[model samples]
Target: MSARFEELDWQPTDLGEISLRRRRDPSSGADVYEVKLDDDFLMSSLFTEGEVALARLGLAAASGDPLDVVVGGLGLGWTAEAAFQDPRVRSLLVVEALEPVIGWHERGLVPASARLVPDTRCRLVHGDFFALAEDPRGFDPDSAHRRFHAVLLDIDHSPRHVLRPGNAALYEPAGLRRLARHLHPGGVFALWSDDPPDERFLSALGEVFQDAEAHTVRFDNPVLGGTSANTVYTARTPQP
Candidate 1:
């Protein structure tokens, strides 16, 4: 099912005065989500179109039949679950910065994340994504992460998302350039953003990689008559 429902069950809070809401679901359980601006929940147990598209683009870029995927951020497992559905996915590594988010999923609070966590091919890297990105030499060649044919990142709202100041580097020209070096030829780097991105991010992407494309996608919302909008930044690695 599409991730359309927002938890009206939540109460208001201040993430140091940023004004946030925590989504509640007994089935998924409490502390499952955090919403910025109170009007929208940032992450949930349900999946969204942006996350699904991240998976689809990743799968399409793989030159090989079965693909190894490295997913940055494991919010509610929507992106991971969507990408894992492809038979071409040989392994999926979900990197999450928040331990509590992982705990919530492990406790069976979120259905999508909970389902994929138990898969044999699934591995959880319990740390910040940058740490993984910086230490490419530290990676084992045969490991699931090192062998990835695709890297899908859904860590923030978009290049514009800055829940943490450090996250901004993920979209910088230098950071994107680093990602290009990590992927196999013809591999794809799919990014999910909460809203349409600024030209700066797009231009930076163009500077770093080849065949860059941005897709504006929307997900149907029963709560909202129209739809929620977001952008997908997809770039290709050169094939040898």
Candidate 2:
């Protein structure tokens, strides 16, 4: 048994004060790891079904063997871990804005780190995901204009509700078009949102991709008692 509550790590970045904490859940008798930005709760290990589903659904939509993937958040490493579960994932490039979060994984502070850090297919890069998405060079630092089979994003709360105002651009039609350039034809782009499906965002995706859909992932909310849901939006690039 560990302490009731312990802050694993904390750091100040341009985004805000970010912290990682671990606490014992009395009801489940399990350790729960959480990440927070200032007072805002960013992610919790207890509710990761949506994150896992983001990668699963995105990869499922991609049509190809030996897929290359780019995950645009490193919170708790659930999305990246889930991506690796698919044997088709030949490489995974996880872009994180905060360096401390990457350190947490390299230092093995998070449970998923044990599985992710040792995997040769996984490469954790410390960079702004939104900036990388808009850049022509794309997510890979060494390879310019590199294309991937899937891009799974779980950084913002929703297309309308973003952590940073600048991030909102990525949800727009122009930005969507720019991101599509980094995806191979028939590639998939999936996003995890705390809010319910937004038709406006779906319409924007439709303008940029050949196909788009929203999936509602429901999971038992242990703390709140009832079930809670998150949305995963998947869009596929046009095939040749």
Candidate 3:
């Protein structure tokens, strides 16, 4: 079957080199978006539900303390925008590798993402999220510290759609260890992925962290443009 086909009732979006197609299921009509990079359907936006839930986890977990956050993968800016809503978040550091994806936001491809997550306390950096997530150079404990209350990541298609070829390393034990190392005590590290399978992911988390858990949540496809369920990886960091 072809990657993208016309649907009678759906919303279509054109953002430079990417195209977003959305449709809802008939029964519940859950929302999902299909992201077409160039001509290929890359990932689905229905996964945003998990992303949102993960963001909420960060918001609640980091509420009491002033939060310094790191968000990987700025897809449609949904998670970043959500995190920005929380007053507890004092600073937000967003890292995305793809320039075209970033351009889509700057060009106002998506409404919420059209540079509208205005908190003035944000730093948008273009680089590999894994590298930034563990940069000792960026973290200065003496002066203005670089501590994170939460690290939310949405790279690759939730481990199932590993299209980028480079994202696999981020899920390995080394990557998780680095993520845990930089996280603040009681800080949250969440990952959103496609489907609930692959025990390897769970094991990878266990190998690096103290407590690891996975949550199954149904989300909208944004690509198929309908409702579907996926998994969210949630882990906690040790406290000093």
Query: Which run of 10 residues does model 2 get worst, by summed lDDT?
Result: 156-165
How well does candidate 2 score on lDDT at residue 214?
96
49-84 in candidate 3: lDDT tens per residue? 676776776566553468888888876777888886
Flag clash pairs in model 1.
25-29, 157-194
Query: Would you list the clashing residue pairs of candidate 2?
Result: none
Error of 3 at 146 (Å): 2.4
Cα RMSD, each candidate: 5.5, 0.6, 6.4
Per-prediction TM-score, please?
Answer: 0.79, 0.99, 0.74
- The whole-model lDDT of each prediction reads 0.70, 0.95, 0.67
TM-score computed on alpha carbons, candidate 3: 0.74
Per residue, candidate 1 scores C-alpha lDDT tens digits across 59-81 of 77566877878888886677888
Output the TM-score of candidate 1: 0.79
Tell me the spans in candidate 2 whose CA falls farther than 4 Å from its real position: none
lDDT value, residue 95 of candidate 3: 82
Error of 2 at 154 (Å): 0.5
Q: How far in Å is the alpha carbon of 179 misplaced in model 2? A: 0.3
